[model samples]
Target: MLKVDGLTKKFGELVAVNSLNFEVKEGQIYGIAGPNGAGKSTVYNLITGNYRYEGRIEFDGQDITGLPPYRIAKKGIARTFQVPEIFPSLNVQETIRVGSRFGARGGLDKKHSDEVLNFVGLEEERLQHAGLLNLLGKKKLMVGAALATKPKILMLDEPMAGSNAGEIADLMDLIKKINQQLGITVIIIEHFMKVLTELTETLLIIESGRMICCDRPEIVTSDPRVIESYLGDSYAEDK
Candidate 1:
């Protein structure tokens, strides 16, 4: 489990993230959504210790406010960026191996690495250069690298970006498997309403860097404020 209270991040005169409070229960798929500049990614940066912030962040009951990014990753938290970051020269297998090597345990976990490769559907492409992958393949590789870290909680930022409908369906199934089959707690920050509603149990909506509402996906999506600020009138009728 993770808890955040009064989490605020300021850059110069701008407050990217306001006083925010939320919790992600163990073994649950959590969702975060808001329009651009709502500080959604800032929250992720704070959680991962990318920048110094005001307030408290607790993971599994310990205060992790100022820990470095590596320290946070060591504490069972791993995340993917909005854009897939891959080493151009490294092969797919080698890239994931690097992840396992830098993971909490700090070793080459061949079994888990192979499992991640297969889980991400890149088994056949394991020997291919990571830079050559298509968009979807690159995203899968990104997720695989995070999985190789053996994280208790996986935070995905815009995992559905730049995908077709079929690709979205494929990824939804993959995300479900990551939560259900792997039993890993998930915190996904996404723009796609359908992905958030269908994949997550608890949805937290934010606006102007603060919490707007946090509840079941259906309820949060149907809320009038969410419809007004983000979802629009059409989403309410879809319910």
Candidate 2:
């Protein structure tokens, strides 16, 4: 479980994240959505100790605030960026091995790494150069590497971006497996309403660094303010 209370991040005169509060329960998929510049990613940065902020972040039970990123990662929190980051020269297996050896708690878990390779559906590409993978392949690799860290909670930022409908479905299935089969808690930040509604039990919508609503997906989607600020009239009419 993770708790973020009064999380605020300010850059010069601009406030990127303002008094954001949310809780992610263990073994559940939580969702976050907002328009551009809404400070969604900044919340993640604060939770992962990327920025000094005015707030308290507790993981499981201990206060993890102000811990460096590496310590936070070692304490069973892992994340993926909006863009897939991979080593161009490392082979797919080697890329995952890097995380296993460096980021994971026990360090260099070969059995777990092999399981992750299969879990992400990258068994055949094990020896292939990481840079040669296509978009979907690269995304899978990124997720696989993160999983290699043996995290209790996984945070994905815009995992659905740049994917076709079929690709999105594929990823949705993978995310489900990550949560259900792997038993890892998930916090996803995505623009795809369908993905959030179908996959997340609770959705938190924010704008301008403030929460508009946090509720069941169906409930949050129907909120008039959510429609006005982010979902828009088209989404309202479509429902």
**Per-candidate TM-score against the hidden true structure:** 0.97, 0.99
Q: For model 1, where is the 10-residue window of minimal lDDT?
A: 99-108
Per model, how many backbone clashes are there?
Answer: 0, 0
lDDT per residue (tens digit) for residues 92-196 in model 1: 999998888877476789998999999999999999999999999999999999999999999999999999999999988999999999999999999998898
Residues 1-239 of candidate 2 have per-residue lDDT tens digits of 89999999999999999898999999999999999999998888888888899989999899999999989999999889898999999999999989787675988998889899999999999999999999999999999999999999999999999999999999999999999999999999999999999999999999999999999999999999999999999998888
Best by lDDT: 2
**TM-score quality measure for candidate 2:** 0.99
lDDT value, residue 53 of candidate 2: 93
Model 2: worst 10 consecutive residues (lDDT sum): 98-107
lDDT per model vs. reference: 0.92, 0.94
RMSD of 1: 1.1
